[model samples]
Target chain A: MNSEQQNATLRKMAQLMRDGLKTQTEPFPETEKEFAAILEELRRLDPGDLEGKMVISGFVDHPYGPDRQRCMECMYYLVHRQWCDLPELAVPVEADWWCRLWRI
Target chain B: MANLLWLQGGACSGNTMSFLNAEEPSACDLVTDFGINVLWHPSLGLELGENLQKMLLALTSGQMPLDIFVFEGTVVNAPNGTGEWNRFAGRPMRDWVTDLCKVANFVVAVGDCATWGGIPATAPNPTESEGLQFLKRDHGGYLGKDFKSKAGLPVINIPGCPAHPDWITQIVVAVATGRGGELSLDEFQRPKTFFTSFTQTGCTRNMHFAYKVSATEFGQRKGCLFYDLGCRGPMTHSPCNRILWNRQSSKTRAGMPCMGCTEPEFPFFDLAPGTVFKTQTVMGVPKDMPTGVDKTGYIKLTAAAKAASPRWAEEDIFVV
Candidate 1:
């Protein structure tokens, strides 16, 4: 996709989350087993179902905790393209965005 | 002539194969150039039946001077300590190890098996396997903690699943060429020359590691494997990247994670499900931090690095 299209998609996702989008953010995966289970849940979703991934992975537009953990710090984040490179997620993301899939 | 004797116990002979494949100071070079006399080897020894028995007996009885005793694999003491399962030359191989270790001037333990009991001694250890001088992190093994050869040194451990080929031959040559005393060993009795550096030293991915770029999947040549992939390169000691396997590349070089085979507690986490290739994490942070990194420091570093990460880090730099 073109840069403008990609930016629009990211903006749309961010707006959706900010507008009281209730996601599966309650159960934060504390362990790898728990984390893997969450990923497995994500895998069952259709790749084209971007909304399903965001909801399942606990997408928040901004940093969530005191540490200010965000997509920029996450291992799967791509700074140049402003994207989430995780094959399971594959969403356009803002650097300041937060998700449960975040890892350093 | 330095008479070198090689033996095996509860092993897969992986080290022997690696030894035979040595390039710089190859196995044949040991005989031709280094003047190492091969008294016997499990694979190379021509003796069979009565002749093999005679050779072993001769060495035990002090008729044949054993300059170096190279032991590969773990010493099996099984079936209620009888050691009857692995017999060599009409006696338990463990029996020969005891005798040979006593007589040999320098004793060298050739792989993870002989150094620290390896996978055979992992858990439930049905074979009752133990290294010549160590069992995992413990000092006392088949050979007692204080046990040393006639050269007044502990068993020289060159550990790996199969130790690097040059490490085996080079140590053997060092002992054979009257430089045995010059060889310095670490706490684990591995030669300080090879075992001193971490596998991360001199790695091609060091740039990625410094910039905190993570390689999420295997065979992606751009990012560091330590972040998400269970790579022990940063903490485990070995000169894999420096020396270069096959004189070209290492496990991490080709995008494979270092298994930390050189360390005594290898096959870490006991080959448990989801342990081998995936980095074990707690709350999305690595469970085992790099050697000395604390959680607070790691968090701070991550925050700074991620924020400061260059745009280039996100792109495929290794352009074809």
Candidate 2:
């Protein structure tokens, strides 16, 4: 998909979370093993399953937890492109949005 | 002529191999150009059995002047501290080390084993091995903290898995040419000249590092290895980038992470499961920030660096 398609999918993800989509957000991965487990889960899902990717990754439209971490500060975030550069979760995202995979 | 004796104990003979690959002021240059009389070396020496023992005895007895003593492994005190596990010319290698170190004008510990016990001295050290002057971060190993050579200097540690060839040959030339006293050493006894810089000093991926782009996979041709991959270049002290291995490229340059082999705590985390190539994180932040950086500053820097990152920073811009 092109950049425009990716942006549309990201917007739909935000809408899903806003419309009371209960996602697994608690028990943040505190170790590499935990982090990798989450990635493994995302990897096992169908590549076309954008909603499953968002739900499983615990997408939030704003900064997260006590640290107020966001995609803007994430190592995998591309600021200019407004995209998540993770190979497993290739989706455009807003600067303020966050997910369980969020890492600085 | 300056007499140099090279020996090994509890080692894999890695440093000896690295020494043979020296090219800058080559190994042959040490004898031909630098006027160094190679008294004996584990690989290059011509003596055998009793002949080798006599040479070692001569140096210990002060009958033959010992200019430089180069040890390239650990001092094993295993099998009830008898040191019999690693026997040398006549007795336990440790005994020979004790005698040789006393008379030599300069004592040089080549490679990590001789410098900081390396892998053999890792936790549950079965061989009870130790470096000449240090066991990991501890100051005193087989030698006491106050121990110094005849020249009044502590054991000069040239640390690395095997240490770069030039690092070994260059230091040897300096010592053989009466410049040994001028050489300054860091707290780890590594030459300050080479140990002062980080392995990341000349890394080609600095742009990716500055932009906070993570190189998720190996040999990606772009992105920094410090983020997703466990690269110790920013914290590791070495001239790997500046000196260039094989006179061409370093590990970082060739898309490999700096293993931080030169550091005393190398094979970091005792080769823990899941710690090798993966960056350790806590609460979504790196467990170990670059050398002196704290978490708060890192977050702010990432936010800014990420925001300021150009279009090229996110893509593989290295052209063929």
Candidate 3:
């Protein structure tokens, strides 16, 4: 997407999380099978269902867990674009954001 | 002229098909140019029935000089180890392999099956199949560890799902031309010339790998396959990228993950569910790190690589 569209979407995501979106951030997918199941749920959502995608993927604005794992180090995160490159969750995200699909 | 005999055990003839497709010193070149006398082969042999047994007996009985013995497929020893399960010519194939290895000057194992038992030797191996000199990572297989060819060398293993065509023909030519004694072998008895490098040595996606950009799906031009697609290129030893399959492309170049077929523990994890194409991770960290790399170092490197990755690294640069 263009820079303007990406920034607008990023603002929408930030606003949702700030308003207490209460996403399913616990029960982090421990294996590829579980991770794939989460992707499948996201795939079934409407293309514009931003909140549904966030809830299914367990996205949080801040880093999660003892290790403080975040999108910055995840293999799928595109740092320059500030995006998750995972085909199932191609969305704008902050470097500090944590998701159940996070992997190094 | 060097007398070469080719045999098959519990194999699918995949290696034979690959051997026939050899380009750099074609199978026909082995006969016409390299002076390798084709005594017998599963596909090209003219002998059949009693005639085939007569030729085999001649080689085993010291009546004819056996220069190079190339073996494809695993040595099957099932059904109470009598080897009655896979009989060729007149007796069991394993018995033939045993006798042939003793008489042959150089023994060359042509595929993963003949080198490390391949897929047949995976977990619950009912066929009781084993390679000539190895059963998976173990040292001894059907042949004892001390067993050597008449030339006093252990079985030279040219391993792959089906070994690269050029590797098979080139090694055969080297042995036929009396360079077999000069060949250097690794711990696994594989020729070091081909097995010394990783499949990622010349991969086109190395920039992506360095930048920690991952190709989440297959056939994507941008991003490396290792992070998400379970690519074994960084760990598996082979000249796949350096030599190039089909003289133009390799598995990694074509965007398919390297399956680590050259390693003894092939069909890794016994083809278990959810393990084939998906990178196995523990607590979001790769289970198998790049060769010689530690978990702490890998995490640190990933952080730095992502931070330094250029904007173009995230885009499809390989435009058709």
Candidate 4:
């Protein structure tokens, strides 16, 4: 995305987190099948439902869990772009931010 | 001239097809240039019926000196180990293999089936298929571990789904040209020259791998297959990238994940659904790390590599 558009999307995501969007965060997908099911759910949502994508993916503005899991260490995180590269969950994210979809 | 006899057991003749396609020292070159006398091959042999039986008997009886005995596919031991499932001429094929190896100067196993039991030896292996000297990772297959040819060498294994055409012909040529003693074999009995190197050694997507840019999906030219797709190139040993398949591209270069076909545990996960193409991960981390790398090291490396990844790495790096 262009810098300005990316910034706008990032602000939108940050606002959702600040508003305490009650996302499905407890049940972390431990297997690919479970992981795929989450992706399938995201795929089913309307592409314009950016907020729904954030909620379903369990996005948090700060690192989550005892391990401090964050997007910075995830394989799909594009450090330079400050974006999540997962095709299903493509979104602007922060370095220290996290989600249940976080993977190394 | 080295008298070479080629035989098949419980095989699909895939190795035979590969041998015919050899380019470096073509199959025809073995006869014309390398002085390898074609005694009898499943495809090239002229003998049929009784003549073939008589010729096999001659070799076993010390009448005809068996120089190079090449075996393809697994030795089937079925129906209570009677070997009745796959019979050659009057007796079982395993009997012929046993008899032939004893008399032959050199015994060479071609293909994963012959070297390490291939797909036939996968879980619930009803066919009772066994490699010549090793079955899966177990030592002592159809031939015991200590068994050797007249040349006092263990069975030389050239393993692959169907061994690379060049590896088969080159090894045959080497043995035929009297370099048999000089050829070194690894713990798996494969020639060290070819099986020692990893398939990822010269992969085109190595830059993507370093940057931790995952392909995520198939046929994407921008990312490494190892992260998302079950590309075993980093762990499996083979010169697939160096000696490119068809002389131009490899599985990784063509955007297909390396299936780890060269390894003994081929058709990994026993062709289980979802395990074939998708990377097996535990808690978002790869189950199979690169050779010599541990989980802690991988986590640290991924963090560093992804942090340092260039912007171009996230996009298509391949230019037309």
Candidate 5:
């Protein structure tokens, strides 16, 4: 997507989180198999189902744990693009935002 | 001339294919230039039946000098330790290996199989396969831990899935040229010269590795494979990047993760599901850290690197 399109999507996602979208933020995937299962769930979603993607992936607006794990430290995060680069969860995200699919 | 005898056990002859492709000091150069006498090789040997048996007998009985005995596969002792499962030249190959190793000046374990029982010795090993001097990380494989060649050195292991072509030939040349005593070996008995460096030492993607930008998929050309793709280059001890496979590229250079084939615990996690290409993590942190790095340091490094990563690191800078 172009810079304009990405910004619009980013704004929409930010607004949804701000409006208190109840995403699955508990039972964070602790292993690759669990993480893979979540990716499999994301794969079965409609391409445009952004809300479903956020819900299943356990997206949280703020850093989630004692270590405060977030998108900035995730291996799949593209820092400059403000995006999650994971193939299953390719979506715009703030650096402070997090999801269960996060890995360093 | 140095008499070199190459034998196969529970193997696929992949090492023989690799040895034939050696270029730095080609296989032909061993005979033509380095004065290595090819007594017999499974692929190159002309002798068959009684002739091969007679030659093997001569070497074992001390009638002929066996300068270098090169082994290419795991020593199989199956169906209750008789080694009949992998018979060769009228007897079990392991029997021949035992006899030849006792008299040979230098014994070289050529590939991962012979060095540390490669795939054949993995869990539920029906063949009861084992390496010359090691089984996985443990000492004492088919040969006892204290076993040594006539030269008083343990098996000089040149390990890889099919050890790099030059690694096999060059070490052969070293032993053939009577410089075998000068060779230093690691705890695993691999030549220190080749196994001292990590595969990540000279990698082109090192910049991306430093920036903590992971390549999420194969052949991505932009990021390092370590963080997401189960690359063992950081912990693997091999000069893969320095020596360069086929004189051009390595596994990581081609965007395939280094499988850590040279290390003893190869086929790591015993080929467990979802473990091959996917980095194993615990609580979202890498299960195996880079050599000498702890979890806290890795986590801190990742955060700093991600923040400091230049814009170009996230882009495909390798424009074709």
Candidate 6:
């Protein structure tokens, strides 16, 4: 996508997080089985269902927990693109943003 | 000439297939160049019926010198330890293995099945199968822990789902050529030359690994398979990258995860559903760290590496 379109999407996602749209960010999957379950849940949603994906994945604008982990340290995060690279959740994200899909 | 006897039990013959495909010192080279006498190999032997039994009896009775005894599959001790499941020539193959192990100058166990009981020995183990010298990490197996060949060496294990062809031939040549004394074995009895290096050594993904960039999918040439995929390259001790398969490429080199086939605990996680090809993590951190790395050091290194990763490191590059 063009820079403008990408920026617009990023802004929309940031606004959604700022508005406290309670995402399911707890019980971060502890194993591949649990991780796969989350992926399965995400797969059940319509591809256009951005809100549903966000809620299930537990997205937040700030760092999380005692370790202060965030998208910056996540394996799926693309540093230069400032985006989540997971095929299921291809969305623009802030470096410091936290998500349940986060993995080192 | 070294008289080598090969036998199989509860096996898929994968190692034999690999042996036939040997290139560096091919199967033909073993006979012509290496001076190895083909006493009897399942795939290459010319004996039939009574002749095969005669050859086996001669070896057992000290008429035919058995220089090397290479077993390629699990020694099945099923049916109340009667060895009825897998029969060879005339009697149970397990019995033949027992008799052969006693008289052979050197004993070699090839592939996962013959070395660590492999899939046949997986939980339940209905076949009552066991390796020559080990059942997974445990020491004693079909043979007692103290059991040593006439040459005084325990079973020299060359393990893999299908051991690399060259490893099989090279080790055979070493033993047949009277260099067995020079060969050193690790705890698992694998020759140190082949098992000392990790699979990650010489891996093309080393840059991506050092940078902590994760390869999210198969065939993505850019990142390392460790962080996201279920690659056991870092933890597995095998020269896959060094002695490339087909003399050209390794699993990691071709964008596939190292399945840890060379390690004793292969089919790791007990072949559980959704475990293969998927990295197992706990609280977002990997459960099995690289061989020598601790949790704290791993995390610190990851942070630094990810921060320092160059943009070029994220691009797919064909590895030779």
Best by TM-score: 5
Residue B218 alpha-carbon offset, candidate 2, angstroms: 0.8
Better of 3 and 4 by lDDT: 3
> Each model's TM-score, in the order given?
0.97, 0.96, 0.97, 0.96, 0.99, 0.98
TM-score of chain A of each: 0.91, 0.93, 0.96, 0.96, 0.96, 0.95
lDDT of each: 0.90, 0.91, 0.93, 0.91, 0.93, 0.90
- The candidate with the higher DockQ, 2 or 4, is 2
Stretch of 10 with least lDDT, candidate 5 chain B: B213-222
Poorest lDDT segment (10 consecutive residues) of candidate 3 chain B: B277-286
Error of 2 at B103 (Å): 1.0
Q: Which is superior by TM-score, 1 or 5?
A: 5
Provide i-RMS per model in Å: 1.2, 1.0, 1.0, 1.3, 0.7, 1.1
- List model 3 lDDT by residue over A1-104, tens digit each: 89899999999999999999988887888877777778889889997898998998888999889889999999989998899888877899999999989999
DockQ of 5: 0.89
Writing each residue's lDDT as its tens digit, candidate 5 over B38-90 gives 99999899999999999999999999999999999999999799999999999
Model 2 CAPRI quality = medium
Docking class of 5: high
Supply the DockQ value of model 2. Answer: 0.77
lDDT of 4 by residue, B199-306 (tens): 999999999999998888776888899988889999999999999888999999999999999888898989887788888888888888999999999988988898
Instruction: Looking at model 4 chain B, report the run of 10 residues with the lowest lDDT sum.
Output: B213-222
> Which portions of model 5 show Cα errors greater than 4 Å?
none
DockQ of each candidate relative to the true complex:
0.74, 0.77, 0.79, 0.70, 0.89, 0.73
* Candidate 1 per-residue C-alpha lDDT over B1-320 given as tens digits, one digit per residue, 9 for 90 to 100: 89999999999999999999998889999999999999889889999999989998999889999999999999999989989888988999999999999899999998999999999999888999999999999999999999989999999999998999999999999999999999999999999999988999998888788778888887787788998788999988899998888999999988898889999999888888888888889888998888889988998888787778787776568777
Clashing pairs in 3: none
